[model samples]
Target: MKLQQRLIRLSVGVLLLGLILHVALLLGYEQLTYRDRALQDLRGRAQILALNSAAALAFNDTRAATENLQTLRTAPAVVLGCLYAEEATLLAHYSPSGARCPKRPQPAQGAGSIRHVESVMVQDQSVGQLLLEERLPTLAERLPRYGLLLLSVIAAEAVLILVLVVALRRRVLIPVHDLAELAARVTERRDYSQRVSTHGSDEIAALGMAVNRMLCAIEEREAAIKENAHLLQALIDHAPAAITMKTMDGRYLLANQQFAEQLGVSTEAVIGLQDIDLFPTPIAQARDQADRAAAQAEGSLRVEEQLGERVWLSERFPLRNAASEIYAVSAIATDITEQRATQASLAQALANLTQLNETLEARVAQRTFELKQAMDQLVQSEKLAALGSLVAGIAHELNTPVGMVVTTSSTMSERARELKAMVEGGSISRSKLTEFLEDLGAGMSLIENNSLRAGRLINDFKQVAVDQTSMRRRQFDLGALIDDTLHALVPLFKHSGQRIESSIGPQIACDSYPGAIEQIVTNLIQNALLHGLAGRKDGLIELGAHVSHGTVQLTLRDDGKGIETQYLPHIFDPFFTTQLGAGGSGLGLYICHNLARGILGGKIEASNHPLGGATFVLTFPAVAPQRASDAS
Candidate 1:
């Protein structure tokens, strides 16, 4: 039963019990009082009759005695009985007609020759004994009146109890029950606006107030969350990058409009489809490999993949659950096929420019031999025009490494000085120096133990800046070249409390100018650390290099402030900087862009890091060295 019903029943039961006990006690008291009163009246009348009878007998007046007896008999309250001593002499008796008294009634208090009796005596002799008995009124005369009175009192009490029950139900149970129903409705419909009525300052009213307050809080939080979700959806819908999410087992969970458009499919078709399901042969393999790598590393992985005639710059990252397990993967791809074509065209242009330089140099030498004075002015003009374009492109390519070298070399010089001072102060003993020498002697290390990194930085820069200033090709491990570039730049990152982490795949051989590859990697790492972590104090820079199909792809990323969507498309432009004035030379990425395109026979692009930062990806084709016969 409900609480209200239980309470009401208990209350009624208690009231009924009290009323029944009270009625029973009252009836018992009334019955006992009536019986005592009747007995006393009978005793008083018997005493008067006995005294009068004794006086008449003592006077020897039979007539007076008989008259007195008749008079007593006529009295409304008296019944007379007569007796004779020893059953010999006659005596008088009186009783109501048809009222039978017991033939022998023994009385112990007094007797007229009986064992116990109330008697009248003459000259010390007992004439007869008087026996009186009291009779109570009948049920027909009194029981109906008493029963009516009892029933009236009970009816009044019952009416009072019912009134109180009705009042309680209205003032307490009704309001409480209404509030419970309102709560149920609110839960069913997920509507928080319905409120309970508060009629008084009782506990129920307080409960209503608490519920209203809770609903208000819930509504406010829900509104804020919904607003955030709307804003995020708007961002995803309009983002320039193609964004999508897929299950860990390779089923697509969601694909934004941009991704759908890039894949030339509808969003409905793209969702729930795996890479192999949605994409054709080669591109699907690249995507699957990237997804596996991302899941394995539990981090982001980027790969350059070709779909039909288009090139996509794709990044895959593991989406983790609360338990730190990879639950899904999110991918963002940018179409860079046009960018790659532009880069190839630019490389061809640079090669033609180089051929023109060599031809002009040879022509100048020949003309000088033929007529030194006549062709001087003409040679100079040709040199200037050819030099101008070379200067612009090469300058763009050199700026990144030059800037990084300057930064890293300076820090290395400082560290060297600090080491020198420590040694001079006896912090490094002669025994420690001997141990270091022994360790170094154990390997044929080309770079010096003390200044190897700084020296390599200088050497790498010189190959691009001076020694191999012309477009020259060589066969080398592209993965190793990237690794060496990151190693050289470690000091600069160390100065900023950051580390360079690399995942270079096994000996990826490529025929390309190492200077260009070095410059591209240097620029990417520098940009990731400098701009990606603009305000960060400590961070990590990840460099990954691998050979797939006929190309070597390198990805550099960092944990820092991610790029804004508006600025992502324009990062590779000549002079675009999100950090307008705070020491941001837009030429950094611009240089990296041109080098990857012009000198390295590759393509470069920038994007927002999925794990929150910036990422630069470079893809270079593997080629064989040009033989002397082929050059001719």
Candidate 2:
């Protein structure tokens, strides 16, 4: 039993013992008083009978004496009565109804006359001695009835004691039992909300009050613990790095939102699941090893891992329970894909700078001799510069068609592989071969269509390249250029479940390189769709272009996960990419920036949108109207 039950039992036992003792003492006193009063009544009756007998003897009338003797014989407590002369002769005798009195001893001369006897008594008289016997006949008749009455009183007292015991049990024992059960439940469940109720100002009530206060304190502490847990969970969920908690056995116990998203799975699906369940082969083994290292070391462990095309910096820390036992391992991963790329790029730049320094040093030795033939050298330099510009223009023009060809070839190869699988699986039966052939013919037609599309892009690239190399200006609709760029990138966005909503106002003619503007818009839209939507399923890309004042402004925005505030400053750096080896060239944005400023004569700025996403703003100067005379 718990302390509460023990206390109640002790208190109840003491109370019952005290009550029994009190009742016994009271009953004993009552019985003693009743016995004393009965004895006194018997003595007084005997004395009165003796006095009446003396009066009868003093009259000396036979008939009156006989009547008095009869009256004494008929007395309730008198068993026998008689009248006699001084010599102690029996004048008249009477016995109590249905009872015999014991024979009394004769009184000696010196012996005291029988003043009081348990049997008979005689009174001194002139004619004869008046005798009276004290009989217990009346007492005998009342004895059985008194015994029955005493038994009834005892039975009533027993019933009252029983009722009191039951009341005490109900009021005290039952509540104490309930409180004990509640306490047991609190211990087992670790839930401290339960409390006992006290009804009145009794000791049990005071005990209940004390218990309730203790429970309140425990509950308050439990609430504080829960609040702390919630705060910690919130912090983990909002953390920028991918965080996960795994058991020592390599089962995931908890994962933050970013971790689940990075793994391309739901948090619920990842919990209690081992790495092998989500990933294949070496990745699972690597994760298991890391978890074991953390547990064995009883400290933090860090390792760099390459999963697919991205590199991750993973740190694991041993999570210990209250008993200092290793319960789990907490792993935090930072996608260091971009950082690794930056390091590689820095190394390449150093090599290039070294090469450039070597070239400069080689040319420095010939500077004094070249000064005499400076004019001829200048002429040769201009020719070489023009040739270099021409080669750059050709390379730029060829880039569009090469990109188109590569995209088409990859799509065709994937389709061919699918068709081969269908054939091998018998999904396409011999009977359906003719239909398959027809489909193949249609696919060839599609290839031709795409080929022409690539040619058109090539033509546009050539025109823009020629214009850039010749330093020629032309009038072109900015809205039309944006529309063309959107059309070209529509297939890329379509596969990713993204829709572009464009709000192109009335055509604003601009005197600039139209191809450069198209390239800039294409790079911006592709970046928004890929990086912005990263791991998201559904997203929207909006492109708004219009004439603001004399400048044409174009805004491209996407409703995807926005970039972190810390990374905003480094976004425009050359060869920087959030996506490193996952088909990111890093030159897309760099080329776009250069084209916007150098060719389109525009300024571009990027910022996080208020609604939650990334936005790029581009402004181009309006084209000036030229007369036919001025053109001539």
What are the lDDT figures for the candidates, one per model?
Answer: 0.58, 0.59
If scored against the real structure, what TM-score would every candidate get?
0.34, 0.32
Q: Over all chains combined, what TM-score does candidate 1 have?
A: 0.34
Off by over 4 Å in 1: 1-156, 281-286, 349-632
For every model in order, what is the number of clashing pairs? 8, 5
Model 2: per-residue Cα lDDT over 1-632, one tens digit each: 34345444443443444443354554565555654454454444443333334434434445645655565533455555555544444445566564432343232211211223222222221444434444333434644434423333344355544654576587777766666676556556756677777787665675577567656755775578679889998899889778998887788889998888877888788998989987886988988887888788846888788888877778888988535788888989877676555444434534543453354334333332333243234335643443333333333333443454445445534554554555443243344445444443443443344344434433433333322322335777777767766665554554677788888865677776665576677678768766998777688888887786788888889988877888787776565777878855566666666566656667788899999999888887776333222243
lDDT of 1 by residue, 22-85 (tens): 6766566656665555555555445444544554444444664555456444344444344333
RMSD in angstroms between candidate 2 and the native structure over all alpha carbons: 33.9
Among the numbered candidates, top TM-score falls to 1
Q: Model 1: how far is 565 from its true place, Å?
A: 56
